[model samples]
Target: MGGEIKQIFEILETNARATPEQISTMTGIPAAEVEKTIKKAEKERTILKYKTAINWSKLGEEQVWALIEVKVVPQRGVGFDAIAERIYRFPEARSVYLVSGTYDLAILVVGKTMQEVALFVAEKLAPLETVQGTVTHFLLKRYKEDGEILEGEEGIKRLPVSP
Candidate 1:
């Protein structure tokens, strides 16, 4: 990507609600060019979706989040892709990734309660033919998510200087 295009991507990534005109103003690019570039990016799947991150805990609607580590035996022809596709299709799965670690796949799942998340894992996730085992770790608290601080003030962190 050219500098202008990459700059546009960064600006949009920071604030998805930024209009093409706003981005053009910041980058000193023409608004029409910015709009055309954005349009092309969207068509090519470079710009996938604009999303909002909410801290639902503040609104008294807390969601139970779980990180499940899955060990799977890759299929002969398709390897892990087939099993990964199956895992990601579940509604409970918030994010699925093929990780480089002891586990084959890492899945982030969300539900109303702990039992609900456990039920999904028990009834849906762990039952796959290629799935060998699963280890689930429930999220107790979230201080930061998607580069945004969910609690306290968003400020620079530094150690106190002593001379």
Candidate 2:
């Protein structure tokens, strides 16, 4: 079980969208076994979710991505979860995390334009009762995502060396 679990995770870490048959073929495990292991991993929360990596820039969607540092006042007993839930519910929010430092939360957001993102931050996010302050930084470029290079389809090339 441990070996199977490890193989499953290794395959997923390398390629998140790898099919069960591909994993089974690569690991020499039965397809049914791979399926069972994946289910177990999902149930254990080791595998949270499956997602696709998109090149939004190439899509010409006029998209803007930003990372927002947020300071929030936790409720007397509810803690950060209550406030985090509210932020995550927003459609613009792509990801959220609890981080250490001056800020309590880090949120990733995407919008159609800079103005749209700013509106979301100023009108929707900042006005929340628990939110104290926010700092936003827009992403200019990404070198890689999900272990794939964003620039081109070419893999790393090695220079010829004399024997």
Candidate 3:
């Protein structure tokens, strides 16, 4: 995580499609060096995957997303890791995190409809042996995701004042 490597990571994070030559130009590092660094990062799992952020609303495709806060009884010796692994193994659970606060884990899930998500919660998620309780919150809208604005940027406007 030196200066040059960190800079390259930042640049690639913003635009994954950026070529090593483009990153080198912005970072002022040699293209060969940039390529080598990127390759090393990929091998080491520092760079997981190149992804595109899409605003699905524009496509008019209906999708339901929910964040479920789960309280689980940590297994003896194994702790929350085992429960987390079990929860994340489900395809519906897109993202699972061991978080600090009232809940032991927070999971992000997606479905085609609200009922489908609710059924998954009731039939799949809630029945787990380690799960103590769960509170689900559906996402109504997303203005921003992964540092990208879903809606186009709005220009600032000010009301005129008269003396």
TM-scores for all predictions: 0.92, 0.82, 0.91
Better of 2 and 3 by lDDT: 3
lDDT of 2: 0.90
lDDT per model vs. reference: 0.93, 0.90, 0.93
Candidate 3 wrong stretches, greater than 4 Å: 155-163
> Candidate 3 lDDT, tens digit per residue, 1-163?
6887799999999889999999988989999999999999899999999999887777999999999999999999999999999999999999999999988999999999999999999998999998999999999988888777788777667667757
Per-model RMSD to reference: 4.1, 2.9, 4.5
Q: Which is superior by TM-score, 1 or 2?
A: 1
Local accuracy of candidate 2 as per-residue lDDT tens digits, 1-163? 4775698888897688899999989989888988988898899998988777778778876778899999999898889999999999998999999999999999999888899999999999999999999999998987887678889778658867756
lDDT of 1 by residue, 1-163 (tens): 7887789999999899999889989999999999999899899999999888888998999699999999999999999999999989998999999999899999999999999999999999999999999999999998889888888965767768857
How many Å off is the CA of 99 in candidate 2? Answer: 0.8
Q: Deviation in angstroms for 27 in model 2? A: 1.5
Error of 3 at 42 (Å): 1.0
